[model samples]
Target: MQKSPLTSTGEALLRGQLQTLKTSERQRLRHVLEEARAHGDLKENAEYHAAKEEQGLLEAKISYIESQLQSCTVIDTSKLNTDKAVFGAIVTLENIETEDKSTYQFVGEAETDMEQNKISYRSPVAQACIGQEVGDTVSVDTPSGQIEYEIMDIRYS
Candidate 1:
């Protein structure tokens, strides 16, 4: 499996999620399944069916997360040079068309959250920003259209 680059924070978050799933979630789901099974017949019991479905989903998620963890490579941003944009770099950019400035922290796919301004390195914006330094202009093809941005700052954290 190809390893994916993950920031320290991203790796920590993934580890936290894995721990929660292994301990709290797994135990809770098992208890729920037990209760559901005790209720009635498996074929027609709504609660039993729901719990079984939930178990399947939870197991799938656990497997996927485990696979990602197995292929993850935690990247320490502190030791990396800040001269250019790279994985784990927090980049500030100005949209050339709107003159609106925004900041984004490039992170692993598992940790990408748009609300937090964290984008996956494989995302269009992050791809454009990669290897770019301050004052460099890059164009990203978005669903809305092609947009251009000027790199304003790059920080490790």
Candidate 2:
């Protein structure tokens, strides 16, 4: 199986999620199931059916997270070189056409949060920026059109 890259923070987040699912969520669901079972007939009890469905979904999520954790390779950003744009690097860019500036942190797919300016390394923008140094310009094709950005700074934290 191909190993998926994950940031140390991302790995911790996944582990926390797994722990929550196994402990608090599982306990809550068991209580819900027990309450549903007390409502009598299993065939016609909507509450019981709903609880069972929720339990199944939770279990599936737990299993999926476990699988992801097992196959993940955690990358320590602090130990990496920041001379060029790379995974876990915080890169600042300036739009060549509009002169607008933006900052983004390249992370694993599982840790991507656009609202937080965290992008997946596999994303088009990150792909274009990877291996590029400061002052380098990269053009990426977007849904609207091709946009060019010049790298201003690269930092690893």
Candidate 3:
């Protein structure tokens, strides 16, 4: 499979989650399973069965995270150029029609958290902003309609 791009922050976040799962989460599950096992027979114990199922899901998640880490190319956002909007750039824009302002960080897929205003580099807004500089107007086709935005500022790090 082709390696996917990831920001250094995203890589660190994934590594932290993996560590938590391997240590605290695993230990907690083991304790729960031990407690369940002491309750009754293996075949009829609902708690034991549930714990086993949860353990399977946890293991699957761990495996998925490990694979993702292995298949990613982490890029440090701080080393990028701030002159033009590009991957790992935090771009500030102003809506052409409404005059509303918004800021978004264009990052790799793994760091696309809407709540944090981090958008995927492959997203429409990011694609429109890429290679554009301040004062450049970009049009994006959304589900509602085409929206125009002027780039106000671009920052990296």
Candidate 4:
């Protein structure tokens, strides 16, 4: 399978989640299963059935997380080039039409969080900004229409 990219921070977050799932989550689910088993006969036990379904789903999620962690490659941000809009570079963009400006950090797919102003390198904005320098203008096609942005700055930190 092709390896997916992950920022160091994203890798750490996933690892933490996996650890929690394997330890505390598993222990808690085991207790829940035991409680449901004590309720009575397994033939018509709704609580037991529901708990089993939930436990299966939880185990599936844990397995998925484990696979994802194995298939991801963590990237080190500090060693990357900051001269242009690339992975790990924080780019400030100005809307050519409205003059509205926003800054976004280009990160791996797993690290994309809108609330944190961190976008994936594969995203349209990052795709447009890639290999671009300050003062350069890039146009991106959106559902509404095409939008233009001027590269204002690029920083590593």
Write down the TM-score of every candidate: 0.91, 0.95, 0.95, 0.89
lDDT of 3 by residue, 29-87 (tens): 99999999999899999999999999999999999999989999998989985688888
Q: What TM-score should be assigned to candidate 4?
A: 0.89
Q: Which rank order by lDDT, best down to worst?
A: 2, 3, 1, 4
- Model 1 is weakest, by summed lDDT over 10 consecutive residues, at 1-10
lDDT at position 76, candidate 1: 86
Error of 3 at 13 (Å): 0.9
lDDT of 2 by residue, 1-157 (tens): 9998999988999999999999999999999999999999899999999999999999999999999989989999989966999999999999999999999999988888999999999999999999999999999999999999999999998
lDDT of 1 by residue, 1-157 (tens): 6888888888888889989988998899899889988987888889878888888888888898888888988888888976999999999999999999999998999889999999999999999999999999999998889999999999996
Scored by lDDT, model 2 comes in at 0.94
Stretches of model 2 off by over 4 angstroms after superposition: none
Q: Tell me which residue pairs clash in candidate 4.
A: none
The TM-score measured for candidate 3 stands at 0.95
**Which residue pairs in candidate 2 have backbone atoms (N, alpha carbon, C) closer than 3 angstroms, thus clashing?**
none
Backbone atom clashes (below 3 Å) for every candidate: 0, 0, 0, 0
Candidate scoring better on TM-score of 1 and 4: 1
